[model samples]
Target: MLKHPKNAVMVLARCFSDLDRRLLLLILIPPLSLIVFFSLSSLSPVRSFILGRTILHPQQAVMLNSTDSQQSDVVFAPSSWKDELDRSRIAVCLVGGARRFELTGPSIVEKILLEYPNSDLFLNSPMDSNAFKFSLLNSAPRLAAVRIFRPKPMPESELQLRVLTAHNSPNGIQGLLQYFNLVEGCLTLIQQYQKQNNFTYDWIVRTRVDGYWNAPLDPKFFVPGKYLVPPGTNYGGLNDRLGIGDLNTSTVALSRLSLLPQLDAAGFHQLNSEASFKAQLTTRKVTPVLKRLPFCIVTDRKYDFPPVRFGVPVAAISSPGPLSGVKCRPCKPVCQGPCVGDVMEGLNKGWGWTDWANGTLELCNAHGDFDEGWEKMFDKVAGKKLSSERKRVWKLTVEKCIANFNKMRNRTGIWDTPPVDEICKTGITSGPK
Candidate 1:
């Protein structure tokens, strides 16, 4: 039974030879395959593709650990933010009269409307000569609602009289009430739309029709959990000209008429629009975030020419700004550089004064009506397309105005205004026969 050692070893090797080969293949193949894979992944394009897929696809999110996810969330690129906004539902509530819609409307359409084409527009304005110009909104991507009601004088309640001031308000306390009604009425319209559709908006942008935007509304301004408004022109309160917030915060901000009782109860007396706005937000515990927005309230109201210190310095429409809702119009800039510093130094910081640092402020001689040849100035600044709109409005006929209004009315989800004929003809015909 015992064989020679060499012969015995040879027999054993023959028996195990097939098992050795299989073990060798299994152990070597995996490491070899991994080496090849890493070698290919070392190429720039391949590496980038792998990383990009990992970042872009949430299904692959498991590849990143908790630390990596935290880091990635902290560093958001602009494109990512834009993508988020593109997916979000936004309501752009435009209130106030369409006094200079020719100048401001095109800008709103191009900047806000076109920039976020998915957003819905809610327009609540009073019927006036300028009302016809709102038909420009037909170009909007989504027209949610339109209410261009004729102003029957609102009976000023004793509470409104107690809570508001007439100082600097042209129509006095009644004017403030009317303006408040217009703003709050827009909110009511928005609420109704939400209820009917059975969906809620993610963001609400409340801005004036008279505000002329020079640049698109930035996505960065839409801060979560806090309401955003322009700084300066506080005038014993916050700037009420432009606001952006979520539905909860905007509900607090836009409840102008409903909040009067609360304001009165809180002993807030003789508050201007801005002051009242600040009170409402503060009392309701809404956090306000101020950022310089790239627009100005286009106004025909004249200020002192070559304004002295403490005087309102109307900015030229062409001034480089995030003007923060300062009063502006088309005119040649008369004051700039050191002149701006000197003029602003004399102005009260809490009043209508805006941030004029870094030569951002430019003055206009607003002593009289928009100076002759101002159209040329405005054209140069607003560019050809907007200028053409201005010209169209100037030459708008009774028939065309009616046609445009009718088109907009048909498109609007909610239309509450005078008959298209009455709105068109009242402004078109000159005489009080």
Candidate 2:
């Protein structure tokens, strides 16, 4: 059993080589697995978790403006403005608070990219410094939305009264108060961006986070010298439903709170979206162009139209609907001997609603809960590239958004980046654009 000293050295060398190989494999697998995981997540198709395909067009090309029937799906317009909004022109703006955006965000994106393929999409939401806020919306005409300012939650007494009576809603003035703040923000956007950039919009289309659309907005709706809004579902007056106004008109209309005193001094009372719609026109001398749109309010409130004291549900014909300013889907054409005749009749005549009552309703069933099977349904209607972008962001869970958020918060310059100023030309920097 004599063994040479050199034999022991060889055995030791073999063991060392095996140990090195093991170490290499250990280091390599985790990152490789992570890479695969991230890649797979990116590849998974994006489905609107809340607003499904109900409001989107299955084929994206269908959304391109009729005139520019061959535009690209992704439009990065080099940050410019088109002042005179023509019938052929498209303008898109996102109006939301950047909270719970994941629920109905896709519907807004799909609708804009679809309806106004030739349009430039603008984002004007306020978000927290958290990375999750604007991730769903950074895909299109992205401007750093305003920082959302939510007042401290009021006491239960005030909350109950505010919630119960339309007159007592926060910031009073009923009918989409936050909408006015958002409008004011957008108007600020228009004023600052336009002044610095010397650019204007033909039409400013304002929409919300929870509005799930079932169909595309047809171009025939745009008539000159008129603001277009969805009719019916106007609690007392205009729907605030979705608004599209030219620069001259929108400048004042979107100035919600600021304009209220002007409206009030002009004898505006019992104003809701509907009454305000009339007052904005009758008082301010701006007439609205009523159009039946394909969208439904994705709200958290319950309405008791008739026979049900205060908390009866007004259900949609379809579950996940765009409900595009049309007659609501009746569970049965003639249900229960017209118990909710007022709700049904107001819908039928088309008060201030911009829904699609002519045919089927684009239903959205996110009632304090998201719709089921929405993923598949959304996939059916979403644009390929947009879906891909959403997938990319979600999969990566891009945490850098916090950086973007903070960076925007620290920003003081408002006009530098808008279409008006050339960084090279201006030399003096104003942080916000």
Candidate 3:
């Protein structure tokens, strides 16, 4: 064994070289593996976990990286967009029944109207028991017009009959016509305001009276050339719940009634409201930009649980959601975690589907009216200020309501509603309840 000392030295050198190679491999593998793993996570249909949050989709990854994501749920418009909103004249068109205005109004004022303080608010709603609750908006920064009309039957023309269908509408074709009238009425109000003020609005934000906003409206939605709408709840068409656009695009989008003839000419038929909305826009060459927004339509309507493929899925109001104009109600969540995943997986993505990933959605039973003491649930979720507003409305009296309406009238550019007494008396009595 001691015969060849030089050979032994060469063998020892080879072993040392092999040891160095092994050490280098050890040093490189972990970081390289991490690089590969992260790269793979960026691909589609793959979920990436970062900071304990799941990046469920490619766009979500972009969203997380963008300045749009914030620690607080309240999302602000980019500084540039904020500047644009400040300089630009914005007309906020609010339509729909004031079913739960007491619960929803403060959020709208705080999140949207106040977010863009320069924007003018125009409301076109049918007068109902809840109409008096709209006095909550007296606190709005800018008031343009308010129209609380007694809804009447809209004449369905031949073209409307040809183009629209009554399939899923609870009120049939008449319902659609009334909705179209409400939307167009707001547009008319805006136009009249412009003529009176001698200045045209640069933007219009069309939303519903019953939309409860969980966060501030993102300013990125104000796309100049495109009409921005929420994603999902599209029944064979685009989501028509909320819309934001520049003057030209908004004109086309808001002319829901007047655009029927054009849609008919383009060979679109048997359309529901959402479908008709999509048809009108596409026929007019206005591109719809689908963006997830931080508001939901507050509804008292009940729907099936664990929704079937085409059935509507009712979301819980407390869900950490952008909701994107989906129907939601205040209730105890009946489903969460994997239960939600399983339920949402069964629904049609083109129908009532909404983003439920990363615990963003929770389901409400919605098989009946709001759960007992849902008010407490709402207060907890909405926090103190909004909860106080809700309490104020609950205890509102005719005199106070009238005073609130008068205050709103004083600030408003045009007030086309009935006498303040009539409006207040309809919803509230002589004294606090």
Candidate 4:
């Protein structure tokens, strides 16, 4: 139907006299189709953008269908996946105070650190009486850095004041700044490790010290080009509790303090931590993947029972949870089934919301202190292994705590904390007679 062969080739190439015209013609021509197919097949498949710092195309995202509850349960494990992870370099950056580390630390060691024994652990936490509890990290497979610095007032810049809001933060903007400092400080440690080793890490896991994991972090959550976060508990932005990403994307995620100027330039104002987290990722063109992860934030803070539209829902530790980093505590459940449905339906999905479908969630009436005998409740829910860890911390003496800290310090690549004697004696004292 073409006037000439050149014209036909032009139509396929969208131009004439091009170097690729012959190649295009070969691909388009029916006679060469089989030959072209075989040739291309042998040329190796085009690699995905995931393994590098390139922006991922939307079509490449592997996300659970938001409406399909069962999609979250489907995990495809290639035989070589775990072996591949073992070969890859990973950094696990833990931040925040070890307030309830006695309860949460063991779960973290078992579920995350041991799950991928190759990962190097880095902790950036403020030194306090509870910090001695971090001696529990003696169980970690590999120690990269431990910085238990004493807290000080972080200087708040004009840009930071403009970009961040004190709306929901307990200690206002200063608290947010302190938190940002902790996260960014951990990033500095990771970068320094890579610089000293002359090699970059393949992945970085940034998590809170207070988080408790009910199950192992599955390999499926590691999508190469995208930053992974637990779905829900996003108060006007992304969930900031736990994050997983490749080095490039994680660098942006962990630059919580350094990126405020960029956020200010972008006209983002009065953003909460979660909202700011989402903004930073969007500003850098880093795609965020939301998956239902099996972890929860163990907190002593109480929330109103039968939460309203914008109120927080505190979950009971006994719930069948991939709680997705929602606030939870060891307590007797006060709501389930239809009751949960009623409460969750009334809450705003954009704020203080988490997946409660299919009996996966149970609510706790957290208006009061932790239920009497919560230690026993925690032990029962945490099983034999983690329960032993709890008991160990409960009965820990200054002498034993110092011994554990010294053991951990010996294994650590960088020890930035105070002396083990000071750390242990500052916290542990003789128990009441």
Q: Which residue pairs collide, candidate 3?
A: none
- Superposed model 2: Cα runs more than 4 Å off: 1-91, 114-118, 128-133, 141-178, 300-322, 325-359, 362-368, 371-433
Greater lDDT among 2 and 4 belongs to 4
- Per-candidate TM vs. native? 0.82, 0.56, 0.81, 0.84
RMSD of 4: 10.2
Task: Give a tens-digit lDDT track for model 3, residues 187-282.
Answer: 999999999999999899999999999999876677667788887788879888899988999999999998898888899999999999999898
Q: Each candidate: what lDDT?
A: 0.84, 0.48, 0.85, 0.86
Deviation in Å, model 3, residue 415 alpha carbon: 1.0
Better-scoring candidate (lDDT), 1 or 4: 4
TM-score between model 3 and native? 0.81
Q: For residue 14, what is the lDDT in candidate 3?
A: 95
In the range 1-433, model 4's lDDT, one tens digit per residue, is: 9989987987877654564778778777986777766555343332212222222222222333322243432223333566677789999999999889988999999999999999999999999888888989999999999999989998888888899999989999999999999999999999998888899999999999999999998776777788988888899799999999989999999999999899999999999999999999999999988888888999988788888987889999988978989999999898989999999999987685678989999999998889999988999999999999888887889899999999998988888988888988878873311
Error of 4 at 214 (Å): 0.8
Leading candidate by TM-score = 4
User: Which of the two, 2 or 3, has more lDDT?
Assistant: 3
Candidate 1 clashes between residue pairs 3 or more apart in a chain or in different chains: 310-346, 310-347
